[model samples]
Each structure stands twice: as structure tokens, then as C-alpha cells.
Target: MRKITLTLVLILLLVQSLFSHLILQENTAISTTSQFDTGDTAWMLVATALVLLMTPGLGFFYGGMVGKKNVISTMMQSFMAMVIVTVLWVVIAFGLSFGPSLGGIIGNPAGYVFFQNVSVLTSWPLAPTIPFLLFALFQAKFAIITPALVTGAFAERIRFWAYLLFMVLFILFIYTPLAHCTWHPDGLLFQLGVLDFAGGTVVHMSAGWAALAGAIFLGKRRTPNTSPARITYVLLGTGLLWFGWFGFNAGSAMGANGIAVQALGTTTVAAAAASMAWVFLDKIWGHKPSAMGACIGSVVGLVAITPAAGYVSIPHAIFIGIFSSWVSNVMVSKFPKGKIDDALDVFSCHGVGGMTGMLLTGVFASKQVNPAVVDQGLIFGETTLFLHQLVALIGASVFAFTASWILFFVVNKITPLRVSQEKEELGLDLTQHGEFL
Candidate 1:
């Protein structure tokens, strides 16, 4: 069975490589005429690298939280995404996500398959200030990390091959459509004036709800390992995520301008506020505050600020950070105590934080801060924007949750998702990868 799956994967990779070679040959002549700004181009180049770094940062964040026996497996999931998702994106996923709209639901895959027309010489029509190639690769990083985030929910037990299959499906069906709907020009949500400065809906909400679905479908672990292996790793990961986030959020402005400056400024304030709020929440609950608690708190803050990064002022950002941290800290504590084995609280931090941050964006968004703001937030006396945000949130949550659940069911039917009880007991590093911490 292992050989069959491995052979299939290799075959797919070979086909993908051939397609890439074809695109490379075709790409030589498809030079773009769009003039680019050096400042925006330079910023986007750096931003792309920073966003790509987040996946490895996620590896540390999640890897340190799993048991010693599962650390390599945990980290490898993120690393695998870095490898696999880039190829998938280059081949077709990017077109499915950002191609010309199809009824505001999906993009035309034929347009971008193998990146046939993607060009370094042209400024992206979407951003117009940066190279189209940079835009594609940057978005690819976002795609890569989102699925990697789901590994946290069922860590320590899931078969890696089953996971790779599910990752492909989820990226194609779930992540692509959600992104096209929310971020693509002429997308249903974009046309309706739903603002997502970064990827609250496309990344966090989708990954979070999918994590919830995986937990439900996979069932509980035989003996759940709740304690994290290394809090220091989590802290280190948090710092990396926080640093990369300047590029993640500010970079989303698609240029290094005042909006990017505002995003960078708000990102700092929000994370700091949330970290402090998290530790304080622990003390209020009669538990001693710890470094891990602060790290998680800070991440929740970063997640919450993602959607609101460019739309709100620093003060509102601070509130967003505190409120999101409080909600996630509560959920993280209460969620795992239940029957479900979301090993590392992916839903609690990413899902809950993303939703909270997105909704709050509607509360604090203003045209004064970002001229691109078509509708002011509820605080600016426009309930319409708030209502729009709510509807988008509900829509994204339902679709991601439902589609992911079905994908898990289908993948499980093809191959057992969880390993044998004996292999699982011995840990995935040895049984799955033949390596160990």
C-alpha cells in the first residue's frame, strides 16, 4: 500500500515537472508591458520572502507543541507544504484562485495552468505596482501555510499519505474558491464590499473550520498528548510569526505606502496588547501566567489583527488584539477539555481569532484610514458594512467546514487516515517517517 501511494505521488510529481518545463519554455516570450514602481516592487520582493518564511515559522510553532515522539512529523507537515503547495500553485491552483472570475465563484484554471502567461516584467493588474510573478508567489505562500495549519488538529496520529491527498483536495476545492470569492477582483464578496485586508477568511477561517472538521471526522486519539513538548520552540515560533506578519499584513497593502505603514504600526500594537491580555487572563483565572500562554496570546492577537490591519487605526487595533486574545484564550482552555482531540487548538487560535478579528474589522473600519474603504464600519454609523462582514463570515465558515468534512470522509475511504494503534503508540516519527527527535 505504501509503495502504491508513493509511486502515485512520484508520478504526479513527474507530470507536474513536465508541465513546469513547458510553462518555462512558453514564458520566455510572454513578456509583460506593465511598468512597475521600484519602491512597491522592492517591498513586494521582500514581502514575498517574508511570507514564505511563515510556513517554516509555523513548523516551529506547531512542532514545539507536539510530544517529543511527534516533533519531526509535526514539523515535516509544514515543510511538506512548502514543497508541495508551491508546485501545485505554479501548476494550476493560482489560476483557480486569481484567474478571471467565473460567476464570482471560481477562476478559469486554463488561464494560469503551468503559469503559462505569468510574467516578471509586468506589473500585476491586481496590484499594478508590483510584478505579477511576485503576487503569485506571495499568494502561494499563504496557500501553503493555511493547510499546514490544519495538521495541528490531528497531529500525532494521521497517516501522512492520507494527509497529502487531503491537502491537495482542500487546497483545490476549499481554499481556492474561498480565496476567489473574497480576494479576486469581481469576486462575490469583493463586489459586495466585504473587506479582508489580509486573509482572515481565506486563510485562518478556512484552516480553522477545516481543523474542526478533521477533529470530528478523525475521532479522538487513543491517548491524547495534551502537553506541549517545548514551550521555548513555541515562543521562538511566535516571534518569527510576529516578525513575518509585518510582511504578511503590511505587505497585503500590495505596496510600501502609508497604508502599509499603518498596517505595520497596527500589527505591532495589537500583538503586544494581546500578549499582555493573555497572561493577565491567566492570573485572573487563578492560574499562573507562563511563557507559552503569552506566546499563544500574541499569536491570537496577530490573527485577530490580520483582517483589520489596514482598515482600522492603532487604538481600534489594540482593542481588536485584546478582545481576540481573550476569546481564543478562553476557547483554547475550554475546547481541549472536551471529547474532541484538536491536539494543539488550531480552531481555538486560528479559527476563533480569525472570525473575531474579521468581525471587529467591521466595527472599526474607516474610510479616513484607507481610501479604498468603500463602506465605513459600524462605528462610523454604517451597519451595512458590519452586516456584510457578518454574512461573509457565516458563508466562509459554513463552506469551509462542510467541504473539509466531506473531503476527510472521501480520503479516509481511500486510505486509513489514522495509523494502526501500535504504530501510533510508537509515535509517527518512527512508524511514519523512520526518524525521531
Candidate 2:
């Protein structure tokens, strides 16, 4: 065990050293080209705070849903992401994402080392009304939350120390590259005309696929207790995620503008519609309407509209919410019989819902809402956007799944991922965290 741990650490250090000099290009920097707007800046500041809060909210959400013995361990996984991912972002993760382009696959590793050339005085061109530093921080909030989201799929079984190592590896390799491809200006997916209003492609889809990989790699829980610890916590988490989504989706506009307003509106309508739809679907399926059902449905709706919020209308968002909630609901219902165990249905709610949202965006998107939209959706008689989104869905999902699966597999070999059967019966709360309810 000691030898394997040492080997992993050494390999990590070697990779970090190699990456520092991977691709340095100073001449390709984007000059500050616009003045900052106080309103936009303030809105973004607030939005960043809101998004940051969602991570803790996610902890509560996951904590409540897991078995009592695993609750603390599950929530701690999210809290760790908030801490660890920020350190990585401040170091080099941010650069690998938003720094100068490298063949459209990644950013220059040396471009934003220690945020060298980045400053508060300058504005990010993509969001010219806000300081570059602010942009970086807002994006950091995103980097922090993604890995936390993946913790849901392998709640009780994972070893905490192994999980931490996996977080570092996953963030650097899987998450960073996906963010670069989807959000950076010169990225391959961006150049392909794939429109992700916020993170249907980057955040949700990537996290969703990675969650699937983790669940598959970790295998099913050894013991049988899978009941939720607290449904109220799920509701609270749902509310927080739903509320933070206004910032998550609208803040992507980077300014207090009509696009942000449109995103905010769509986000609201979608959650409402989806929650309503989910409850009724339960009724039709012979199950009584329940708070847990409503909460999960609402969140899936939020995930579904995240990619289309800036490009679609309220009515479109409603349709998206209704359809996506039903799809995820069906997945939750049927999956109990499946071999794969996605504990909290991360892949079902976020993965399938993200895919549903992305395809719906391709169908309903319009340049009228946000001129930055690459093109109109197929509803407006253009098929290019639809095709591009499909490519992005397949490409990003496959990349995340393949890379994460291999990473988990190798990491497990180095240090076991799933707890031993004895530890499994003991409960992670006591064994992992030395806590008990």
C-alpha cells in the first residue's frame, strides 16, 4: 500500500513538472479592449457568491440522500472539492482552461501560471464589463463544484484519501480539458459552432459522464441499506441549486444585460415546469406525489435548461423542463433493476438531462435572445447547430467517460477505491470520518 501510494504521488509530481513547460506562448495574449461596467461587475460578484454557495448546498443535498453512516463522508467529499479544486485553479487549472489555445484541445499551460499576466485592472474580453480577476474567480467557483457533483455517484464505498487523489487527477485531466474545449474562444467545440449557454456541455455533461465512470468502476455497494437519510435536506439542496442556477446560467452572460435577464427567466420557468411535470408523472406511474420526487425533478429541469437559458424562450424552457424531468424520472424508476448502481442518480439526472437539454437547445435556440449564439436552432430552419451540438454531446461524453474510467481503474490499482466489506458494514461516517449520528 505504501509503495503504491508513493508511486502515484511520484507520477503526479512528474506530470506536474512536465506540464509547466508544455506549451508557452506569450505573444498570443488578448489585450484588454473594453471598460468595466459597475452594474455588470456587481452582478457578477453576486453571481460568483451564489454559485459558490451551491457547493455546500450540494453537500447537504447528497448528505441527506445517503445512508446515515455515510452522510458525513458523502458531504465531506463535496466540501473537499471546494477546498482542493480552488488550490488547483489558483495554481494551473485555470490556465489549462482559459489560457491561450493549443491546437483547440487545451490552453497553454504556462499562459496563466500563478495568474502571472492576469490582473484586476484588465477585463476579460468575453465578459469585457468585468475585471479579468473577477472572471477568473467566477470560473473558479465552477471548477470547485464539478467534482463535488461527481461524488454523488459513489457515495458510501469510496476511500476518502483515494477520493482526494482522484479529485486532483480528474480536475487536471478531465474537467480542465472539457472546460477549454467548450468555453474558450479558440476551442475545438466552440469553433465547431457548439453553443453551450453555460455548461450543458462543459459542467453538467462532463460531470455526469465522469460520475457514470466512477459508479461503474467502483461497482455496487456491498451492503444493502440505500435509503435516504433525510428528504428535507434534499429539498433544501434542491432549492439552493435551483437558486444558484440563476447565477450559474445567467452569470454566463458575464454582464447585467438582456441575455442575463433572459437566462434568469428561463431558469425560473424551467424548474417550475419540471417540478410540476415530475409530480404528475409519478401519479400516472401509480406512485403518489412526494417531496423527493419534486426536488429531484426540479433539479433535473435546472440542468436541462442550463445550456439553453441564454438562447431559448420561457415557453421553450417549459417544454424542455417538462420533457427532461419525465425522461430522468423514467430513468430513476427503471434503473433499480439495472446492474449499474448510480447511487444518487447523478448520471440519470445530470447526464441524461444534460443530453436532453443540449439537444433541445439545438432545436429551440435563437440568435435573437443572445447575438452570441452561433446560429439559430433547427426550429428556425437550420440544421447546422443541431448537428454541432450532437457532435459535442458525443465527443465530450465519450472523452469524459474514457478518461475517467481509465483514471479510476488505475487509481484503484494504486489504492483501493471501494472500502473493504468489513469497512462497508462499519459505515463511512465512523470509519472514514470517525463520526456517528
Best by lDDT: 1
Clashes of each: 0, 0
On residues 1-437, what C-alpha lDDT tens digit does candidate 2 reach at each position? Answer: 66755785576567556654532344235465558899999999999999999999999889999998898899899999989888789778998999889998889867576565667777766887889999999999988988898999888899998998889889899888889988898999988989888888788888899999998888888754578998988889888988888889999999999999999999999999999999999999999999988998999999999999999988999999999999999988887625788888999999999999999999999878778776789899999999999999999889999999999988888788988989989999999889988
Clashing pairs in 1: none
TM-scores of all candidate predictions against the true structure: 0.95, 0.93
- 380 Cα displacement, candidate 2 (Å): 1.3
**Top TM-score prediction, candidate number:** 1
**Candidate 2 clash pair list:** none
Window of ten residues with lowest summed lDDT in model 2: 19-28
Query: All candidates' lDDT scores?
Result: 0.90, 0.88
After superposition, candidate 2 runs with Cα above 4 Å error: 1-34, 336-338
